[model samples]
Target chain A: MSDAEERKRAYRLAPCPAYDIEGTESWLEDMAEKGLVLSGDGFFAGVACFWKTEPRQLRYRLEAAPEGTGLWSGNGGLPAEEAVEINEAYGWKYVANRGQFHIYCTDDPSAREMHTDPDIQALALNIANKRARANMITALIYFMIFPLIHLRGGVLLTAVHMGSGLMLGGLLLVLIALGRTVARVLHLRRLRKRLSAGEAPHRKNWRRRALYHRRSRPIFIGLTIIWLGFFFQGWSNENLGGNIMPLEEFTGQIPFATLADMVPAGERAGVILFNPWIFQG
Target chain B: MPRKALSGLTESMFYVLMALCRQPMCGIEVADFVDTKTQGEVRIGPATLYTILGKFEREKYIEVIEVSGRRRTYSITAAGLGAYAREIRRLQRCLDDAASEESQLGRESRE
Candidate 1:
């Protein structure tokens, strides 16, 4: 590639492994070693931007911010100015933050660890743990509310109104979100317990997990899209009673057995009409 | 949820209070003081140091004396002094109890 092309190609984007702190740190370090340095931006949107350059070793650390402070929407928040300055003094440069985690990196090989004390690091993680617990509660409430209010007549009746495909897709999505929330809560709890016991977080091979997520996400999203397509198709089709038409003007076979089907050929049969969209009180 | 009150001092917390006994200090200065006081035995990470500082300030145990840019200098409050003194007395009692127990055990062994 030409120089300009190479410069243009220098910028690259990758999916971030959310809530996997050690994995993320190792992933970023690996990227740095491969000459793709994190560009200190876009981590909040569950993606990281990197710039291609000469390969070098770098150490990345994540600091968990206390809940309800900077992350109102889980995007674009830096740690406190004082905290950043103190760490900066110790050779750790403040980088972009994703959710509650403030990312920092240093090129100094001898720079002191961002958290030298495991007990203190565990104390720091308590903030993230609180947020995870809150998220789990919220997800649980959502999971409960969906069935209580909407599925009054049972799943089949609700499914009839909102097409079975849409209903199933919606339920699956809610379940997936709830499952993720539960998993995060459990993971944070386990990690906090380990930290409380004075154990530090250990690095893992992030490539395998990252690649798995990258492959699975598309399949999950594609299935959701297909189900939504089914819903819209069913919603617009006249045969499903989505559209209204006069019985005399209707030439197609009636969906259900009507009064006309039981009457003799010469006798007249009364047609009772009701709106399919409206519920009769 | 009910917030847990800071009742007793951990080793890090005690050392931090000890560091502030002399004069007001910033975050890095406080860490250095604790390190030197403990002869490098106790090293406070940046996060731990700040968290303690923030919590202490919140509970009126410490107060910010000066703020310049990103550096905050903190001085121990009267409440902070009381807490530190209480912690010291508690440690003294613990040591005295251990000494007494050890002496009694030594006598029994000799007997």
Candidate 2:
């Protein structure tokens, strides 16, 4: 197989992040049931690697790292070595991790549920919320700053140079990233409120929401494909001076005055006289 | 659980503290004891058990007496016993108050 094909074989991106952890876990479980087991996960929010295997019943758990729990930075950093050691001790094999939540899976049906107490689950989610809020602040900073850099001069002029398609593609990506981040933060806040009220977190769980829904996965995958296509198309059309050269514009400076100037009525459109750059009849 | 577990001990927490007061047991054993004592009525989630154990340790209510393989044995401290006894007394008082009210109501009915 070619190198590109091999690389494609290795990685398949998921539709969401650990913030939509419930959906991701459920999705992973479904994948596992289908004999595609998630073996590793990368840093990118939507990236997950899988291994083909015999179908088996598997249970996946996502736990928000409690405050002062994770070994390293705490406050929702990572699951520490000790934490992994302890979880392994408890028969939970570590599967993957993203942001504040650590993922684990066990095939034992009677291995016991990850969370028995809703109150403690709520507290763990609270710790995760602080981290989620922090991420949103960081996103807010970038969201505000990114547009300023792009909109430095003016929108119309930028659009003309960058190609409206290109700009729109970028804007689409930014809006999506912002939307997902904001939605996750809001979901956490709602969960936290329910938890603090001594209500169960699973009542109207965030897993089945639109953001984490199975149907939304296709939309995200489609968007990524479109974004990549548009971005590459724009990238290839770029000029040396950093100005965009759209596919329509030819090397000649003069715009097509009339269809007869270049069509069968005038001359053959293929040949170009390249002697010191001059158009000849 | 609640921020102030002292205010009202959750049934699981209360049992955990109660079991530990009697013997130094590992996590699974504690869970088993609770299940058996309640005649399989109350079930503790592993996550909840770990969280409660961690909190109890943090508060010095329970101290780790031994670690054998993956199992860490914990026994209740003086504070844990005190808390458990206090909760029991509170529950007893409430029950006693209900009985007294019932007797008074019975006397009124007789009249």
Candidate 3:
């Protein structure tokens, strides 16, 4: 692959959690001079994409974020257009948004940093946390609903016996995501407190090292392949089911004397018959 | 957190207000002026200046006098002047209190 194409390929699978916005901003700046300008990121889709651009160092910063307005409505608290206008006046051009966080970049050699005061930065982070927690709550509900309804209504004994790797994988995803979300929320609250108390935010030491974009692509591709397999399996089972009770086999000449006589009567023995979607005569 | 008013302005805030009091200036100009005024001791980052400018304008401490493309020239309002004066008084009080306390210590030591 060409250098730009290789960077583009690497860009699609990288994810930086919301709690590490500053770290991700620094990472983006580092990536930008290498010709991969951060064009977009999907907090909901869990990926970040970059655009091939000329090689020039640019500073990246996260700005006014929506409380919890999903990816499409990154409108956060301040309207994006207005935010852009205001920020542009300050020399920071709006790049794109991730979740509710608005990203900006500037190439001005003398451009002032977008975030100067630690206290304001801390407050912005706290606001972002509130939105993140809201999103997490929704995601948590979805995780619970999926297992409770589709995964045999939370019957662990039955689910375990079924032995579906997909089920186990989904559950693991939910657990890991939940743990990470909860941890982030707690950390944000603490950091917010320290910032409010006038102490400089000292969180870099505890931050998770940014996952290399190039390294994560294969893992992401593997997950996508597994998901497609599950989807096809479901589609096949629905449309190409094995059991079929042909209508041609049961002729109108066959008459039942009575409903009770047709079916064997002895405590109404229930025969579990297979049902199929498409029947062929 | 509640917005900090005139009583508790930081060094950067004080210098920014001081810079605006002299003349209308854009963010870049203000930063440069402050750097010159403080002799490189107090350096205001561009990002920090951008934030402070927005805030000062919002609080009516400063008013935009002119906008030329991305550059905006801001002049201190009456309120900003008052804030600067109050901050100066606060520092003066601290110095006066320190000087008196030192004199008392000297007398006590002599006795």
Highest TM-score model number: 1
| Candidate 1 residue lDDT tens string, A1-281 | 47874573344334344677787888889888999887765353355767777899999888887533354553335677888888887889987775557788899998877876666677677767677568667755655444434543666775776666677777786677667667776777787787778777757777666666766656666776786576556545534666667779999887998766866576554322343333464
DockQ of each: 0.66, 0.26, 0.20
- Tell me the TM-score of each prediction against the true structure: 0.76, 0.59, 0.54
lDDT of every predicted structure (CA atoms): 0.74, 0.68, 0.64
List runs of model 3 lying over 4 Å from the truth: A1-12, A15-18, A40-46, A64-66, A69-82, A146-169, A186-281, B1-111
Cα deviation of A158, candidate 1, in Å: 4.3
Clashing pairs in 2: none
> Which ten-residue region of model 1 chain B has the weakest summed lDDT?
B43-52
Give the TM-score of chain B in candidate 1.
0.94
- What is the C-alpha lDDT profile of model 2 across B82-109, one tens digit per residue? 8899989988999999999999999999
Q: Is candidate 1 or candidate 3 better by DockQ?
A: 1
The alpha-carbon lDDT assigned to residue A161 of candidate 3 equals 39
**Per-prediction interface RMSD in Å:** 1.5, 3.4, 4.9
How is the predicted docking of candidate 2 categorized under the CAPRI scheme? Answer: acceptable
